[model samples]
Target: MADDFADVYARLRTIMLEAAPAMTINRDEAGALELRMPGIDPKTKQPGWFGTVTTKKSYVAFHLMPLYTAPDLADDISPALAKRKQGKTCFNFKNVDNVLFEELSALARRCAAT
Candidate 1:
């Protein structure tokens, strides 16, 4: 991971934990950090959310999967996600901004609550 990506991930992890203490943050088999709330299922659940922060060759990417496949989410995040060149539900943040981080944290909290 790039240094900036690591920094952003650390900041995001802190923000997320602060907002939703019940959620768990861990590394997946690919070494990407997976943020998940216990008891939430991506399938058979109304709101199943998960996210990963990754560092690719050119940029740092944040991929968020919103629960329930809501078009509202795509509509809401389309501007920020305009840079994506691959994947179904991915958002690329060239630089992590307060607004984006806060929105992500809010989403995490909302998903955890459901």
Candidate 2:
């Protein structure tokens, strides 16, 4: 495993945890952390996904589920951080970029609150 992936995952995981400290932790293991909204979700009848940090082969992925339902939460994202976005709500990083990570942290907080 690349040290970059480990470091990136660690920081991203911290951002997720700090952003949604009250969210249910669906999984927390060596390379993945999943945070979910407490209580059963109306749509899935399972805990709603708040976010996740996973170590991928080439990068660590931070997924914020709220961004899918509330796109406006990302309106203030910096271009540098926006470039890391992989899809509707996933950000991929190979290394820790403090500037972008801080931006992501803010975004994650909004996502958690939303």
Candidate 3:
């Protein structure tokens, strides 16, 4: 793990928490962090996994599960951020700056809203 990774994780984690206060936080023993909105079992009323964040050795991955349910929101992501996407819903970043943070902040709000 890089020395600066903690800062990167903190910034991304803050955005998730600030944008989605209702989500449940699950701290992985390995040190990764996740903010999830449970999916009600409907019949059982049990909470299921919704979305999350997992910090890897090289980059911090933001998993917006809502994207799978509502793909339209992907349109809001900038071309800049789109380039950083590794998969359908994961956006990975090794370093962050003001521009990325602003774009991500908007994305977080939109993700939480959706």
List the global CA lDDT of all models.
0.57, 0.89, 0.74
TM-score of 1: 0.59
lDDT per residue (tens digit) for residues 1-114 in model 2: 467688888888899999998899989998999988986889889988888999888888899999998989999898888899988999999988998998899898888776
How would you encode candidate 1's per-residue C-alpha lDDT over 12-40 as one tens digit per residue?
55654566566567654331556665665
Worst 10 residues of 2 by lDDT: 1-10
Tell me how candidate 3 scores on lDDT.
Answer: 0.74
lDDT score of residue 50 within candidate 1? 61
Pick out the ten consecutive residues of candidate 1 with the lowest summed lDDT: 77-86
Best by TM-score: 2
Clashing pairs in 3: none
Clash counts for all predictions: 1, 0, 0
lDDT of 3 by residue, 26-114 (tens): 66433376765655747667564455666788888877777776778888778888998777778888887669778877877888876
Stretches of candidate 2 above 4 Å error? none
Residue 81 in candidate 1, Cα distance off native in Å: 5.9
